[model samples]
Target: MADLQDERPDTGHVPVGPGSLGAEDTPAAPVAGALDRAAALLAVHPVADGCNTLVWTLRQSPYHDIDTPDTGVDTDIPRLRAGGVGAQFWSLLPPSAGPHASGAADQVVSDTLDQIDVALALVRRYPDGLCLALSADDLVDARNRGRIASLLGPVSGRTLTDSLSPLRAFHTLGVRILAPGGAQWAREGLTAFGHEVVKEANRLAVLLDLAGCPPVAACRIAGASKAPAVLSNTAAAALNPHPDNVTDEVLLALRAANGLAMVTFDTARTGDSLHAVADHLDHVRAVAGPECVGLGAAFGAEPGVPRPTGLTDPSGYPRLLAELLDRGWPESDLALLTWGNALRVLRDVEFTARAAQHRRTP
Candidate 1:
């Protein structure tokens, strides 16, 4: 929630190799052809980036326009198109407790509302480029129209302010994803109230993102919630021992719950190269299955943290996919990683919400 600038130092290009592939490996593709293949694949299955902090950057400066090219941040319309990003989950990370944080509960709620306003306003401001997507169907519709499907995701459960009203309100306003406060949930695990939040999110068709959650809490939420959960912007802790990364236990739980573990680009969580990212992706796919892995670059989310080489911004996805391609990932699996899997989770959540609505009162 601080002023997020693109301060990542340039780590030169790291070549893709067979070393990045997991147990179920295929013969590596020629590196010269991988980029072309990646581009061709992306034409149909554009990247559905799970988390981006452009809203946070926009919130910092009134002059910053999302349509502007090279705004000294990670995301922009032109670069997004260049990156083959068809759908994006715009992360609204309102600080829960900070020196600049609101002391009162109402103010915190107000701040959350303000963040949503910023996201909605961007879509309204750029109707030709971005369209608000509330469901999986909407994402496809937007793609067909040649527009970027924008999904709202308010990170941190504290944004709800210990009540379900705000959660319902966020859903009504087109928020589709809710990631509970990881630091808080990690320390105490999901309390009774947290379970209520998950249940209500399920009913509302809001995807639960377990980005910063620990294994115990992530597994519990995955087990309890009918809808599939996601790690919107996290790496595999099996490779990187960071607190924010997803553990193998959580990955197995995702497999059982049909959830997604979107591999992040944060070098602090994963390692600092394209191959490091591929390694994490391979690990997640090997553990959680390829259906459960996706991309959540989390670009510009942590301003000072180092970004992986060739993945410093929105235009870098094709290169990352090329790395995967060179590592011998099939086109079908790559399609799921880029688009299908996220859409499936959204569809599943909507289905679960409809079923819950038939049985329970809102």
Candidate 2:
């Protein structure tokens, strides 16, 4: 743990990573403690047969508490790891400056890819004890063996700059899905469509479709993750209306594509703020058909940040599932929203990538 309390190394202003592992990084197996807790949850809730305890992991690297002032104040490193909280997949954001003339967002995509290369190398070296799960099935398998998975994605989608090539670059680097906006849209514009909208929704649609971007994959502590961008979803209800939430035009847009529509709700934020997004899901599913709806829990382990008015964290996931059940969502339909659909996207990518690799080798 490097005596973190006394040996607080002055790295000026740096983001969290392996260094934060602190005392927990000891060979004594800090994960063992988290395993013990998972054991307890498994004993009571017990992920049902053929069921999965989801970890809708996010990568808020640059924006994590430390940089956010009020949040970085006295974070508990050991406790986070001990809880075996949803796998902390490194959600690396790109740099604001330095790189090419193609524009700032594309530059970040390149820089972030470099960081991913480093992270991947570490996982490859410690496959037995580290990983980057590409699918929920991979997460279930890794949990059975006691390892963490790292899902790859940018906290914001601005890195693509309304371009297809950048999205391709990120996908090539194993970044399967991404959420387009963070507090607000990047240098681009507002995330939600408004009475007098600024950016083009069709452009956002083109970028997501090109990236095959979705929140279907998370990270692991050992090897690589596997998953897909099965469908596109957004939680930008405040500044932007969620097209995935459903309007005839939006529903037609989503229905036209073969993917899922995810409604991500930040428990730390007021749930009412996301109601527009949620109700849209209800309407979209009703009008577009059941296969299109999905859900996301945008939770942050950092303290002080309030959980959305309705949820309590990963433990609260099943409650939402129950709500969907109450609303007459079939078990099969709920499964697709909760895990199945995401897994299929990942598996498809893995299969496609491997097939291409095989063809190249031969």
Candidate 3:
């Protein structure tokens, strides 16, 4: 069966055999074995990205140059499919200056808009390989039709200025997630205006991603909350009891609020091996339950983020899965870590936003 669904107009070519690389369906000889093995694993279950995985634009930055030279321009397309990726939360990160930086707000906004344009252009450029997923169903449909579904979100609330207007504008432009930092636990939490934006995001169903920041007191606040909060990137310290990491009090707050802490493959945060990454996942699951653990590897997109040794690129996901399996992880639990938990959160946010919109329509 095709990974994408009928609603999406076919982009071109039908995938055949194992390791189909979409419209540019070319798998290098050396990687064929890995791709072939990954194909079998993915065929049994869909693989959806729980965080921003595709940031093709980072390759253009002279200062970054993160990917290996062999992959060529926009090389992630083939690797993503070959690795059995079904959906991705492609990040639209603005190359803008922060409040203390030299750039102006207008400049930041312009940079952000440019990122959005690039993302949309990629969708247009690789319609056969990618589809824009606005909802959870779109994600499933895209996978069924043999296409990788893509969802866009800002890496931080800093992308939006001090108002909900820009937030709404982004939503209109197809962004469904927001990572607001002013509400951080280490900080005093959201300012009055920030609180308004969070409320609007909840009403609009835009997911508020903590991105592994310390859990804020506001995250525990009931009525003021909007959408199911998620920690899309974090280390074990952020979710468990540790002197160097987030306090046990913070961990309990996250669990009490029904939030999630998605694990990342960044070695700097998760130690030096795939085993360490698995350890972090296991810890989160042990403390927060399987439903609260998700994948936010942030691979391919983060330029400076250090990846686990041996997990060289997107293709390394299969190895990570294999590592987890070796650790006696159940297949059912693995599925939840890979995509299920994140999907449930996305669905909840989308449903709430749509329901609120319907109420306001009349």
- C-alpha displacement of 143 in model 3, angstroms? 0.8
Instruction: Write candidate 3's Cα lDDT for 151-190 as tens digits.
Output: 8875456655655677788888888777664322213466
Using lDDT as the yardstick, the better of models 1 and 2 is 1
> Which runs in model 1 stand beyond 4 Å of their true positions?
1-30, 97-105, 182-187, 300-305
TM-scores of the models, in the order given = 0.87, 0.49, 0.77
Number of the top lDDT candidate: 1
Sorted on lDDT, highest at the top, how do the candidates line up?
Answer: 1, 3, 2
Candidate with more favorable, higher lDDT: 1 or 3: 1
Q: Give me the overall lDDT of model 1.
A: 0.77
Q: Ten consecutive residues with minimal summed lDDT in candidate 3?
A: 4-13
lDDT of 1 by residue, 270-299 (tens): 887778899999999999999999999987
- When superposed on Cα atoms, how far off is each prediction in RMSD? 6.8, 13.1, 7.6
lDDT of 3 at 195: 67
